[model samples]
Target chain A: MHPAPSVIIFTALSGLGFGLMAWLGFGLPAVSGWSAFTFFFVAYALAVGGLVASTFHLGNPKRAIKAFSQWRSSWLSREGVLAIVSLLVIAVYAIGVIFLNQRWQIAGWAGALLSLGTVFTTSMIYAQMKTVPRWNTPLTPVLFFLYALAGGALLAGQTGAAIMLLIVLCSVQVLAWVLGENSFARAGHTIETATGLGNLGRVRLLESPHSGPNYLLKEMVYIVGRKHAHKLRVIAIFLMGLVPVAILTLLPTNHYMAAIAVLSHMAGLFVSRWLFFAQAEHVVGLYYDKR
Target chain B: MTSLPQSTQKKLGLAIDLDTCVGCHACVISCKEWNTSNYGSPLSDMDAYGAEPSGTFLNRIHTYEAKTLERAAQVVHFPKSCLHCEDAPCVTVCPTGASYKRSEDGIVLVNEDDCMGCGLCAWACPYGAREMDVAEGVMKKCTLCVDRIYNENIPEEDRVPSCVRTCPAGARHFGDFADPDSNVSILSAERGGFALMAEQGTNPVNRYLPPRPKADISGSGQIGVPATALGEETGGAKGFLSWLDKALEKI
Candidate 1:
């Protein structure tokens, strides 16, 4: 995986946005009128803006509408449909709360569930890929869900829940990194298996098909330097998880401190997302003797 | 619509012979030439003449060496293309209904008109068969020469994939595997043709015939016989030159 900037931005931003939406729908802050308007405005901006950024990486972004057609079989299609439906549902709920100061608990809950479902579908788009063994796990969705919930709790200014969620998130994030390191080899994909020549002997690629890099090699056979990946992982955990938790735990509750905490978490989330794509080893690399 | 068909009338595919292929890359070039002109979109090249040139190709040849403790190392030229599996992950993973497998002949294809070029299909494929054309911004892959195989305009004899037709070694065989008596089916049965990455459970229609065991001559007495015989001939010439030098010294 190339860790395209568009996708890193999309997943990180949208995950936070949808998490915030879910919290708002639950009336965590119990905001109304102008406050409700402000919250909804930020949620929509993050969620919708992330969705728009995702299209930038598409080869033909104009035909993205057709992406909603195969929701029955494709997680990507499901993500698209769910994002739009959840956004609409949350929009309606937001209108009622902002305009009339009405708090319909049932509608709010439904919108909240739908918003979370949108994030789940987004995670599935990557998790469903058996070709990338590192991502082909229950842990992928779990990590994604935890990240959303923790980010949401922090953004909604629920310090108590944010501290707890961040602790769980950081622990799971560490666990995922440790487990993911060996998942590719554990999947039993080797050059021998790739070519079905194991019986003959130890198989090794002597020459690639082309002299220059092709689309497959460029997209799937990315090699992140081990030293850089380790450093980035440390930085990501420090900023994304540790900083937010430390800030909320040590400092007194204030608007400025909360803003700092949110910014730190989001920046960390961006780096983690980058590592998520970069470290994934697609099975296709075996043919090229990579990974 | 991205779901696969229950059954295809014909499992049309290629059976490539690793033992016979010389890795001349004739099929690779011929496939590029025929597919670019005949397919929906021409295979595009980015910076073709520049320092970094890359082009979309339907078929490619990879060379590998297989070594064992008992047997000497053997070089095998492996040609790879779309397998058009019964359970194609690529087709099902397409967000748009652009990628599909035909029930008629089991050929996997992309409807470029509906393609969003999100490239999820390419990621799903384990064999790296699908390529996103840089110029067209659409997924391109081996169609098994859909345009040529059934085209009435071309000669009946020419009604096959360009790779198969141009294979100088006759290593590439194209036919329906569904029929028990087809050339591809019989060849696969006799040659122990196997699928690449069978653990993926794609149930690929295409098959590869493994390279035959190479003959061993390491222990044979004839290994250095030629060199020994040449050495004796050279020794005789040296002896005659020494005798001539002695006669000249006496004169």
Candidate 2:
């Protein structure tokens, strides 16, 4: 919930990159070898580069290779495994299409699906967190995938699909914020329940767990005021959806407009991604009376 | 082997008595002292003797003032640590095979050797129990004093967790809950002990005994008619107020 810079960069960049990769596999923006090569390079840079950025947050980045061993139960492990396998599959598909000028239908389709799976795994890393009730909903994955698809379509030069997805994702993002605001309405406990003083009466935290920042408070108790969140949401929607859609719709063929649209969209997405982490309320924060 | 053991031999855990704990933080200090030199690496301090000092600690005593409609406010010293849950999300979420729950005693532990210190397990755990030791680049948590509990070098009486052994008020209990007649099990049964955040579905082995309710003391000489205030109303309203005044001598 800290809105860690490295993780935010990773999720945003990789979502774009994998989105591009999936669209490339789906045979959008048919281009010659050199153009395809450029797209692949950008896609890999965003996907793999975003991945490398993720290591910066690790306490011991050197031992990350061991993370792949526990895929049976851990979503993080599955994400790592899926990323590697998807990159490999995408690599083969890229070579087949760019070098040999052959579609390799099986490789193309498989690569596309796996790239989506890789992004899904990434989203699942947060979506599965029961500690953050706002993110522990079926809507988390849906929003993540929609964002990826919207950004991917725009990056792929598929304005038609990009416009459609941007509209949907923006709507969902607003919905998510609304739902998230009331996420804890049906929480299993109150402060009274947490302290086992329910029968006694209402309970309030008169003393904090600690005065200074502890690991739990620092990491899990992130809070964003409702007014600031609303303003940011408006900015995100205007830039991510309205402006880009307007640009794509009004100047359907202007390369400058398209470039401006993509830049605005990505920037807006970065802000929302930050809010996603900032607004997440971890249940442990309840223990500190911070939630 | 992140998969949990199908049949754990013992459910070794702590049973905290909320009624008796004094919030002295002795258990916290004792845990830090014993664990800093034991099975794991030193629990590193960011600024040990500086203006802003902080460190990784497995056990922490959270003191809360509970104000209830039924009684006056009561201060509850809740010492929290790893509960070693039956369905521990911490162990399952560890990407590396570092976090695991032992089949022998059902105590969840982090194998510092393999831990990459990604901090995902800390996120997975609902209780805020685990702490990532940035200095050692590994997650640290309550091992239930795994090293001391099984060590023959220590005296048999001191083989329990350092927190349990150091609690002066006898509030911390250490025992195997698998045995129906274990001290912890009996204490839970008799005191109506309940698990913290049972709805989280972790099935934590540890229990907290809620403080027994007393006469409603929302106002008055604390309790309206304390035994000490008895036979005072017979004198009249003025005399009763005087008797209540006598009870407020400590104020």
Candidate 3:
């Protein structure tokens, strides 16, 4: 893919925001008074910041009002609408936790569901593009949701709160990675099918009309070597998954180690997100001159 | 607007015979000539006489040589353009509804006046059929000679697309795909026609028949060395020179 910065930032930042919300929604009930209020505020702020970052992706921000209109058919439009709805719900929950003691429980539950809904909408943006077999899978949404939880846990650790939550988040992250890796391989199979080529057969580019790189080739045919990709995948799994969980478990009392683990996890998720876009082989790649 | 009488409109399309296409680029030139003059916008040439010349052509022929020692080398000329898909991704993905499918004939078309130069439709299309007209700031593609085909001034026989009519080798055929008896449909059925990237599920209307084996050009099957010239030996240089002189005298 063309490495659309808007989409990349949106997915990554939103994952962190939603992940934090998921953790806070689940964690707030156990805490009391000032501690709970602080967690809720931080989580709400992250969600809002993520949403703000996503708006930068729009070509014409003025036309963003029209985005909510096409939710009936377009996943992109649905994502925009749902994301706004999620933000509103999160805001309500934050207010409830701060001022309305009796309604905090109900508002927190609503926020959690809305957070998941936002992640689902985000994943659907790419999943709806049936032409791109790599993104057209149920695993996409699942992976997005898990990444959010993983990111939130890492963030909580950095803030010197919720070591146990971090462990749970990292565990889910490992599961997500395993599932995503399997789905990623399956997606490659779909690309082969899209090009009408068998697994065993060699499909070489025999001819290309254009001498220089065209939009299709530049956008779809991203070339990453097997060794480099494999190494990155391992690093991503470790940094985004196991390492954070280990750090949170081993040094539960050490706030500094917890913070480093969280930062490393964020950096790792960024690499994971980059690999997600880079590793995907769109069916249009078959048309490229270089395979 | 006058409403036509209710009826089942047939979808017309082209079925190209790849086996017979000689890669002459006749169809490409003919399509360019017809569409440039009559379609939504002209396919302009950027630098006609300059060192680096480029232009928007509705149709293009790509030659592929499948290298295999067992079958020698075979050249497959693929004449590519708009397939006019039934479920065209470009049409549905267009935010402005500028790109649309014709209910009458399933032909995907763009309204130049409505197009916002967003280039989303171009991205949605996998075939790379759509090209932006830099001068007009609108997308241009093969209309399948829409103007020529529906022109009332032309005769019924001549109204069947300029590219099909101009093909010297009869490689291109245009007709209603809905009619089983249509020439295009019959040819497709007989030739085991295949749609390019059918898995994309755009349901492209156009089909291409695979190339046939080359039997006539390889000449007689002689393994290696040439056979002894008739029965005459003429072994020595003096005898060979005499035979050569005699052969030259006869010529």
Candidate 4:
């Protein structure tokens, strides 16, 4: 995988945004009027802005409206539909809290569920790919859900929830990496199987189809990012999991310290998301004798 | 719709003969040439004449060296394109209904007009058959020369895919696999043709005939030089030359 910046930013920011929206819908802060407006504004901005950023990677952003049509079969379509529905539902609930100074409990619950559903659909976009064995496991959804939950908690200022979720998120992150190590091999894709030449012998790529790069090589055969994956993993875990947990636990509870913790967690998330895409080894790479 | 039809009327695909392919890449070139001018949009190139050149290609040739302890190494030239699988993942993964397999002919195609170029379809394909055209901003693939195959504008003899028609080694064959008596089906049955990456469960329509094993020629007297009895009837060279002659005899 190429670890495309647009996709990385889209997933990270949208997951955080939707996560925060879920917490807000649950009335975690239980604010009304100006405070409620502030919370809803930030949540909407993050969620909507991330969705717009996702369009940046599309070659024809003008035609993106058509992407909502195939939800029956396409996870990406489901994500788009769920995202819009979630945003619209949250907007109605936000109106009640911010303007009416009343909690529409039923709408809030529905919005929260829809918000989480949006994130789940987003995660499924990658998890459904049999071509990328490393991401094809149930752990992909688990990791995405945890990141959203922990990031949401951090943004929502739920100190206890944030600390606990971060701990669990870190453990799962480690477990995912450990299990993902042999995922490509375990998938049983090799040059021999890829070419159906196993009966003949061990297959090795003698020559490539072209002298230069092509779309497949550029998009799926990326290998440069994995060189520093080990170092990046430690950095990601420390910044994402440890830093926020340490600050929230050790420091006296204050707005300034909480803000720092939130910032640190978001930054860590960006790096973690980058690694998530960079380290995924696509089965197509086997045909090129890569991965 | 992105959802595939329950069944296609005809499974039209290629049967590639690995034994006959000589790695010439004529099919690759022919496909690029014919498709660029005829398809929905031209297949584009980036810095084609510059330092690093790349272009979209519907078909490509990959050469591999296979070795076994029991047999000599074999170089197989593998040509790959869209397999047009019975359960095409690329179709189902498209967020838009732009990608679809025809119920009438079973040929998978992209409606470039509806394509947003999200590229999820390319990611879903295990064979790396679909490519995003840098210029067109839409996915390009082996249509199996859909335009040519169905067009009456072209000559009757030129109705096959450009790659199949242009292949110099006659390694490529095109027909309906749905009909058991079709040329492609008969060839597959006769040559023990097998699908690529069957474990993936794509159930590809295309099949590849494995290369025939190379004949062993070692110790055949015709190829190996007869060992001479040196220093028996004829006087052999002494010193370094004598040692070289002894080594040659051992070989």
Quote the lDDT for A117 in model 2.
Answer: 95
Can you tell me the CAPRI class of model 3? incorrect
Tens digit per residue, CA lDDT, model 4, B1-251: 88999999999999999999999988988999999998789999999999999999999999998877655678999999999999999999999899999998899999999999999999999999999999989999999899898889989989999999999889999999999999999999999999999989898999999887677753322332443522143244889888887888899
- lDDT by residue for model 3 (B1-251), tens: 01111322666788988778887888888888888888677877766677665677767776555443333355566677888877777766554445667768767777776665545466567676776665666677778777878888988777977878988888888988878998888898998777777756778888776665565332233323254533344444477798796787699
How many clashing pairs does model 1 include?
0
In TM-score terms, candidate 1 sits at 0.94
- Least well predicted 10-residue stretch by lDDT in candidate 2 chain B: B228-237
TM-score of 4: 0.94
* Tens digits of lDDT, candidate 1, B134-232: 899999999999999999999998999999999999999999999999999999999999999998889999999988877775332344345446333
Question: Per-residue lDDT tens digits of candidate 4, residues A1-291?
Answer: 998888998999999999999999998988889988888888888888899999999989999999999999999999999999999998889999999987998889999999999999999999999999999999999998999899999989899999999999999999999999999889988888999998888999999999999999989988886889999999899999999999999999998998889888888899889888889988888889987
Best by DockQ: 4
The TM-score obtained for chain B by all candidates, in the order given, is 0.87, 0.87, 0.81, 0.87
Ranking by lDDT: 4, 1, 2, 3
Candidates sorted on DockQ, descending? 4, 1, 2, 3
Model 3 chain A: lowest-lDDT 10 consecutive positions: A191-200
lDDT of 3 at A167: 53
* Ranking 1 against 2 by DockQ, winner: 1
Between candidates 3 and 4, name the one with more favorable lDDT: 4
Which of the two candidates, 1 or 3, achieves a greater TM-score against the reference? 1
lDDT by residue for model 2 (A1-291), tens:
888999999999998999998999888877649889988998999999989989988998889999999999899999999999999998998997789887776787788899899999999999888778888888988987998789999989998899999999999999998988877656565666566766656666666655556777777887755349878888989988999999988875777888899899988998899899988888887778777
lDDT of 2 by residue, B85-203 (tens): 99998998889889999999899988888988889999998888999886887899999999889989989999999999999999999999999899999999999999877777888
